[model samples]
Target: MIYYETLSINDAGTTNNYITIRGAIDIGHNGKVIIDGQNTRSNCIVIEQGCGSLVRDWIYVKNLYLRRAAAEAFYIHCNVNNVVIDSLDIRENGLEGIKIIGNDDYYLTENGICAENIEIKNCTIISKSNNLYHEDNCVYVQMAAGLNIHHNYIHQRNKQIGVPPGQHEHVDPLQTHVIRDVKIWNNVFIIDSSVLGHGMILGIQSRPGRRDTVIIYNNYIYAGGHLNPGGNPYINGFVLRWYGYVNSVYPPTYVINNTVVTSNGGENTILQEYAGKFYNNIICQLGTNGQNPANYGGTPLETFASSWNMDKTYVDSVRSNLMWRQWTNDMSFGGNRWVGSGGSPTGIINGGWNVWTNSNWGGTGINADPLFVNNVRERYGYVIASNSPARNAGEDLQAFIESKGLPWADIEGKPRNNTPDIGAFEYENQIPVEFTSFSATYYSDKVTLEWMTATEINNHGFKIQRKLGDSEWKEIGFVEGRGTITEQTEYSYIDDIISIQTSVLAYRLMQIDLDGSFEYSDVVEVEILPAKFDLSQNYPNPFNPSTTIRFSLPKETRLKINIYNMLGELIETIAEGTYEAGYHKVTFDALSLPSGVYIYRFESDSFVQVKKMILLR
Candidate 1:
């Protein structure tokens, strides 16, 4: 029951793990099970499954508000093939918010291999670790076959309050080891001051013949830049190093369309020893590095990211990146060439970076202020302005990532224009209304549309549209939107269908601004269940002279009601009519019948149903 009540899963995935349930959760491997704390605190919640006994279920954990755990918030070591952990608020966990590890029995055949299609998504985790020299992580997965870590906001508040003076902790938002297929996207990694917090630490050794695919994209990493001009050590970004367990040729890691910015430009903002696929990224480094931390302003530190070995591949070709800062460099058309600031390349044209690396690699990169909607100097202000240089200045990523039907939308689920924008956000410059959610549901032969807006500016109202099957959309009704408000406002509209012609209906909303500027929301669809053809028991069964019986029909048909006696003889013909596909009622008057048990038979098309009633007068 909690499994079906927890998740609203509709699609039948390729894995066929989604099973529709209306009963208690007994089919373990078929549906989702939620261990919701109802927003209560917990010491910890452990979902551990040994290799000797694997459930291989579709496990999902969500809606939990866990904080201040003794160790980690959730110690999940499930052998389930796919595990989705989302929408949990984990705070001040001792070490990690979620920790996934396996035992030494990796190749156990008790159930099957522990190959995980794990997804740690849509969760907010914060750790205020006061460890002096210990390392901490928001998510640490050791042995997942394919991991999708996306849409999470992780903040490591390494405040260093309880620690001794002149000592700091180490923190990482995401750290994965030995993950074969790893995808980290659409996450905000906020690192607190006084600690060396890296955005992602992806460690995986090279496979002999098969490639270990790793993709990192569409993330906004705020490496610490408290701007104290006194404290806050350097904040690190992408540490893509594999441990030397099986050293071979490095697999191509695709780092594309990410916005990596630092408040305090510390050491190794983006560091990778080997060559990888880098394309259409925006690296903004504020202030300078260690020793001399003078240039705290938004000046271009061309030496911020260090990727010594860079190349152009299917995922990295046609690189057109943007760097938001003032830089002095010579422009030359070269692919993935890293050079120093205020200089030209002294090496080969196609040779990767020369150790120190560069900022002017000449792949459609403009070294100027990437005017964000808010001030770029702000720690995490990332969305570019309408007049920003980052707008429509990068590569077309929709075709690149969606050719294989991958999830390739911006951070806000906006579609990419032909010429996409740089950074994590695709610049649409949508003013007025920012909708949080909009949905439609069918009830009582009517479609009720509901929506909520996070913030509204110069908003007018919403024009509701409806359609059936492949028909054109028609304006159904309108709900007035909040004029201009910062608080979240919810709106709903009920469309009473006069006729139920189709079993499915689609609805959309056109949110018009006060100044005639308008934007359309995503279309929502609902399937209307057919009305059952049945007769309800008569109300006031033991009546003085009259009783009422209601019947529902699935389709238009002729119906008749007859009164019968206990001997099965017809006493009276009460009603007869051709009724439509809806509910109908009829009154049976037993004024002339004797005070005894009477039977009523309802005959429609070829079916007859009988019900006994008492007439006492």
Candidate 2:
């Protein structure tokens, strides 16, 4: 459970504890593990609990860099269970830069010592806090359970100027209290309006009968206010806050597809108190010097309870009827695409029932002008051009997660195609191959198709197609198009015999575009296994009602593929039962049999193969 090949931990003024891992220690450091806490360290790596009483279970800390930490630089205490902090860089931490503790009086029926399945991924935290009392967060979790903070890049600088506001308290870069199945997705928080407060805070406290199931998706916050070139006093806060415990029973918190941008001394970018479900977000408010006069459009605070009574009709009949008529705040905004400078498209400021805008509530909310490929002035990019109306407009939160779903991609992991192009980047429209990468690989019997393109327009190349199972797609090769480029381009193709044809093969790339327009790319499947057990030969085969039958499988059984005629009877079963080992194809319509000379049989236990075709019609 150790792999340290030595990657420097200078320990300049180390008071001690530059590494105190216990509880099933599995420390790793492939390269750069630098832990220069030259600023007088408090903790530069501690996993806690061991020595006479061990408890940690499978802790795997990855790629680290832990910088000037006079305080916390990665600490996980209280028993721990399956912790995985990945790709970390964690900077100037005179305070918090990752702290996860549990059991501050545990609940969920208290058995004590919490922390379960925690995963902090792709980290880049940069916290420059000189401290003023304490609590300078960049990441701090309290009692946990399956907490997953995703793709992080959190930054919290710019807090100079006599720093003694409240003894300098600049919390939240990500702070969670009584956690439970929490998932903060695709992060990129850069809040620094002198940090008056909130860029991300969940369940501030309260754990009533304990019910927490948050799923914030595709985030990209930027709450940096105060662009004074000699203007005046400034202070703007709140970019995301979800304080809990109001009688407790909270479960419907799912602010989806976010893009939030604020700078005009910020006000509210999202502040919820309960029943939540805002959709396809884009919330912008950049005024001051942050660029384009934006402010007054700030209003996102949901706090329901108008009174349908009966606990708001059973929380409005199990969420979705979305209550709040008794006193107010039963939120449920739709599609969403607001622009800034307070022109008011009703981007959300408690106007209530939203569709686009709130003309007293009748939404479909459209303020137009979402054409950003870059929003200038200090440099920001939300990408959404090519006629940008937020592209496909979006509206499919994976059918409102009843179970585990949503967040397949977007926030730069791309992959969200299926009409999802609202906020957080997912606009790869007008494709003349901007590809970046597409693949398919299987050797020996040959099957290789590679693709790469960082940019290309009006291009006119690529046309490799192949399909076998449900058949009917045949073009096999063609590659040649650099038509218009901007560097980076690579392509390859090879499909020789595919292990004597079929085990599973599906590829696509049409592309073309010099003016002849064409599209279709996003299909790549390959599974080949053949060195025995075979049956191939049935293409156009002198006839054609429909044909295509290739086979191969060296494992996984239960087979039957029949098609006799020419007097052998049993005219069609083409395929049946379990099959999966490799190379298989099936498609035999003959329209309904007749003009024939067909006899195809491929059974399996050990193996048996037969073939003959003519189907001329």
Candidate 3:
């Protein structure tokens, strides 16, 4: 309770105990409640083995910055059911950021006393280890069931400060033991393959003859590999090893709709026993162009091969998994084949979305570009394009998932259509604008909402709605929309949000139909954050004297934006003034300037940026 603003502990009658800890900073205030361990404490917060292990349940911790812990930032010993850790910013921790200790001996939770539910969400954990030790992760569980981890950002940093250069060991976003009934979804893990063991190693210890499923879906894994060329540090992506004997009682594990970009020329997924259904995943070997030089009609790009692996004993049901230009791998359980035109069984099957390995099992899947929105192997850029071949190419798993009573949703929390896409994100292929994507960016003084459309029907325009904090929504502005179109279109709106100051701002688009009907887009929330000085390149670089130059200021700082010639000669001072801390843009008109390459520099107190602009006079 030391770093908490308010602590609420309510007795839940008989089973009574609900503990809540939150940041002390005022909601919407300009600061965070950071707990600096200074490498002194074993853990910032600990629910040790005996203190409340018998009665501790329903504990909620949120919105706190925790750093520099001697060991773990948050440690839960023994077992604590209904535990939730949310919105925690953890960095520079000596060990794991969030560590939970449980045991799975003979399938019993440490003395047969099992915890019911534990959840971690919306937490950003980076650099859990300062490279001092080789082992680190955002979250670690010795053994835990009924665990739900979602909507979190984990950046596994391999930099050890103040420590001598040596080999970092086993850097993973998560490391678990005897995982069962675990659901991990909607999370982004930035994995840097800067260590010896560069992937997750789950020791599935003793096989309990029972049916328990670990569901993994809608996750994005971006690897920081292939940087160090001389060494083979980019070793593996996911390695799941089961130590005990194989048992069929362990029902089906569900890994669905995940987008994973592995370190180039590395194994993507290696499961000791993939006794599950692997469906609708885009697991790409970075820079792989799927041309096996030794095989027929192969064009080698990079020396990349091997994608996914599994055991033949515990065969899996894999379908609609997109392999991006990856040459080949064992991809076990069945034989692998290419997508080409030839014989009946060798050619296209199931809409060319799968290469059925066996008669009963109908999917090893297809290989294509997926046509991602970002089109590059970058973070959070895995969303499929409007016209991506992946759209609606996945096999229907509604019957299977519905039987298991699972919640089917995309990476962005959107419900999937009947014909789903073959990746983490489902295309926003609904009516109105057929909005593929809608996002909001926060500037110091304003917020900008942008959306795209695959196609639109009966769309009159969009009515922008704004909400401050938890207040009621109000129509802020309206932008004209393309009534009806089949082509892709993008639209943007800027909200002058600074005029009325509030800590949080939410915005959404209401697509007004020409027939007077309307539909609402998903709400996007933005918070006021400290600003930094930034300069953007001018639009229409090769322009006839007119282009917009945008820049940002953290404070009311004076700026001098001047034009210079190629020979370091001054041309024109297009803008010079003290501007507020917000999004501002200036129009540069070179009406009289000659056609040549010109340098434009934004000079301020400690910030200076120069870029070239071609002016055709």
Candidate 4:
């Protein structure tokens, strides 16, 4: 049986008090329920006790207008299990709009109650009035065994409420909590934190014990704060305090792939409680409000992100995370489109394992302007058109794919192809850019690089260049021509011969067309002096913890390099690959190991080079 409730619909003579829904209340034939509160009253329909019959149950509530209530306007208690809520708009309520307390009232009186399998997604929970506790929150849950909370937009206006002017003020803000096997994924938490008070804090006296496994992944936390004179924000990251006298032993939680940005003040320590693994999270706190900063400490690993763009004053004490590079004044992650562009400190830093060439949702992570559809509203859900870099760059939630109960792998309702575009949406017929074919040869005077295009329209020619020294790129030349309309078009360029004294001369194509169109060709080099391939001394030689090593390949060869301790038992394999003829660099971090002289060697093709480096404490 399907159950639909609208607080507005009622006969004039009939007085409806509490709408008790029994049996299975599946939504429409499409398995969705729509609940609009505009025409209704009292906010929500209460579920009386003894409703769980192990039947198929799903709750779809939307367009909710909570009018008056002291606590949660929409409360679902009793023996309810397996409930899913979506498109829920419970705004402008007197109190918390939605509360899913998973426990049997009868069982609470007798033996005990068990909270099981509940999911609340794509909902907007907010307040209507200026009263602090009156218009406090949208949703609140407790004693939940397993829950999935994702893609909900939570907003709070720091309006003063309650009695008196300043006394009894809500200094610390409240947040959505998960008790047990809970997963908070891809949700937005906007808390107006200031220098005067604390921001979002989780956990209560009846905390989810130390044995519960909670997973908070891919969520965005936007706290209102600013950068201090020294770069730290004057706010706490997240506070988890236990209230009950006897604390429950909780298991380690997993917090990964999250982006936390502070607006007004500096951010303090992350998570006051323990038991969690925080990985691949992007944390940035700028602006100052004269607050002492804090650092993250645990067995957690900071892979692919260093303290990029953070002030050194705060980073000096907590630069232990594996960063793509050292701490810089800004978060200008190189190779991304937002490298040098000003405003909205969104950029990437090239260092650590977090950098990637392809957008495969892999890093070489850039702080690019995600060109959101409704940026101001932060409905980052929609990516605009074809050129958006965020196209198909969304990471596939492995669990989402597995639990879909569908045969097709394209869950999120996407196309199933070899390499899906990274991110959320996938494009079917994006314009294709191809290099086709190319050839290069070196003569006694100069090296000539040429290539042919089989098909082209708004063809952009190629960009030709050569690299010799540190990060300095010299644009040697550019080729201008129309790619073949129907027939093939040929183009060529010659770098007039210079003394072939150097070990190598690199040549690559920079294709450009008439309409300022272009693309870079792969960097292919020609070696004049085939020196025995050796590993040069690591740069930033007197390094404190990490450094880069530059090596060359005379020919196509297989390479292997391993780091060793004083005893020489192969500490780790730094590099092992089939490298082409060119100078390439790789980094080695000595963060985890002891500080001492470490020996490393390289062997490729038929050449070998051994070197030693000192890692200072």
TM-score per model over all chains: 0.57, 0.31, 0.59, 0.42
Model 2, span 1-617: residue lDDT tens: 22222232221111232232222323542346466666676767877643215555565567767877677888777657666788778898787888888666534332446777788888899888433435677888887777888877887664544555445454567777766667788877775644355567675332456655677788776664444232322322223234443444556566666666555533344444433555676655444543332233332222222111111111211121111111122333322333222333433334444532334333343344555555422213555556766666767556454255555578766677556777676765467567878998987888889889898754668889889879798997889787545667898988896434556778899987654558888998887777677788888796668988888787888899998876788877979999877677889988776685888999888898888888777
lDDT, each prediction: 0.64, 0.61, 0.64, 0.48
**Candidate 4, superposed: residue stretches over 4 Å from native:** 1-42, 48-71, 102-111, 129-135, 161-178, 193-201, 204-210, 225-237, 240-247, 288-377, 381-617
Candidate 4, 1-617: lDDT as tens digits: 11234332121111233222222243433343334344334455453334455322344444333444444557766445556566565555555567656553311211245455667776776655353523254556655666777767776544442234333233233354435556666566655533223344555323423455565555555554333232222345444443233444444455544545443323443534332344444444433221222331111112112222222111112111112111232332222222111222234435423333323223233334333232222323222334544444444445533353222122123343433333333434422235566776766547777776766543445667877544455787866555224446777888864533344666666655332335677777765533446567887766778888887666778989889888987998888878776566789988898778888898765888889988887
Total colliding residue pairs, candidate 2: 21
Top of the candidates by lDDT: 3
Ranking by lDDT: 3, 1, 2, 4
lDDT of 3 by residue, 34-114 (tens): 777778877777765442425567787888888888888888765566888888998988888888876434344323544
Taking the tens digit of each residue's C-alpha lDDT, what string does model 1 give over 46-109? Answer: 6556655535356565655666665677776645456677777788666788887744432222
Per model, how many backbone clashes are there?
9, 21, 5, 67
Alpha-carbon runs more than 4 Å astray in model 2: 1-33, 38-68, 71-92, 96-125, 128-154, 157-168, 171-189, 192-195, 198-221, 224-381, 385-439, 443-466, 469-504, 509-529, 534-617
Clashing pairs in 1: 1-25, 225-264, 275-309, 287-295, 287-296, 338-357, 338-358, 339-357, 339-358
